[model samples]
Target: MKRREIVEKKKAISEIIKAASAPEKDHLCLFSQFRHYQYKGHSFYLKSGRGDKLSSILKHHIQNILKINMEKVYGSEWPSEEKSKRKEMVSPEARYIFIYETANSDPNQMSESVGGRGSQTVCANDTETIVGFVHFRFTLEEEVPVLYVYELQLEPHVQGKGLGNFLMQLIELIACENRMSAVVLTVQKENLLAMNFYLSKLRYTISSISPSRVNQLTGPEKSYEILCKVFGVEAKAVLEVIFSIANSAY
Candidate 1:
């Protein structure tokens, strides 16, 4: 499809998301751009992962970004082996959001690069530079169908700038659309930034099923917490106390 059509589609998606977002979450939509982001000197478009090449690159990034935390929690070289075993992660089955920088334009042809939002068929396999990704799956988390964010990693340059918030809002929107119960993910306890980002920044609460809440003291600690944001009243009611309800609100 033409670039114009893709832009219009993304705008429609963005507006749908904006309308679905609650009043408290309106802050995440402060920026006009949703899939496209303006960085140091690049207009990065958010794309989808496809094919072996994009899958390989996605694994490279997952290992590259999380290697440090993996070593700290799971031992050195853990990510190297894990990444290969999990290549299916970037497959079409899972929802993968990729951010890429627009390559230098043909000066003779097009002078200034146009606004870069993700087109309907924006494939990382054919993109210029893959900067980051947010991969998620719709799955049963503690028996409730939830949008489980498997991985979110950005290049050092793209870490800030409200891109993460925008993507998370997208996650919630996806959950609402698919009738998912909530948004959920696991974060390494050692990764303070991730823990804080989900807990403090995004307002996700420690899941009742999280290892930390399950076995407070001597539980075989995998050093991670499952965090979540629930949608339905019944799900939240059940999840709100799944950890503390039976345990006296520990």
Candidate 2:
């Protein structure tokens, strides 16, 4: 990319973040069908969340879910990782899609009524309960505008029911709708299930910026790998191919 082009791209990404961060209905409205999800006998609805606006109830759920799912994976590193997660969850730029299990008679009908941007839609009833969440943000990765997923956690009871795949598909849709180059996330190398889910099920590739792709020798020492599903040739070059050249230089 040319210097001027990179500058323009950065400006564009900044504007996207600003607009998405605003308490208004816009890009999300483009895909209203994804607001509700039903799998097996379970019915759930998604709610948009801002890091700054998280209620005590939501915050409690976030922390509890993270610990339940990640403590064993992080092991000795969990204490510090937990602190980091707490701080990241509160950043003003952090955006969330919270999944709540609902008691509504027909979830298919709920999907018809809910809009994309939660700011414009009231969601769930008094009987609905929280189940899982996906935390993501609109930001730049290697000067390319992308949606970075910070976390995707589900309650233990909901695992292995294809809900993870459904949520990821929704996230990818939102990324594409917003003109993001790709959907990016990090996964611990120790978490085999998640790695297989993203790589085999979702078809995401290890990003060029991932430690292993950047330097195979020392990269394996890193506990995590960055992964992405690129949308176009430009994103593929910057996110998946750039490090191939970088590795040669190393």
Using lDDT, give the best candidate's number: 2
Report the C-alpha lDDT of model 1 over 147-243, residue by residue, as the tens digit. 7788787777667777788789877876787567788887776677777787777888887777766777854366677888999886686555454
Global lDDT for candidate 2?
0.80
lDDT of 2 at 4: 94
The CA lDDT at 172 in model 1 is: 84
List the global CA lDDT of all models.
Answer: 0.61, 0.80
- Candidate 1 residue 241 C-alpha distance from true site, Å: 4.2
Candidate 1 displacement at residue 180 in angstroms = 1.0
The model with the greatest TM-score is 2
Off by over 4 Å in 2: 1-6, 25-28, 108-128, 241-250
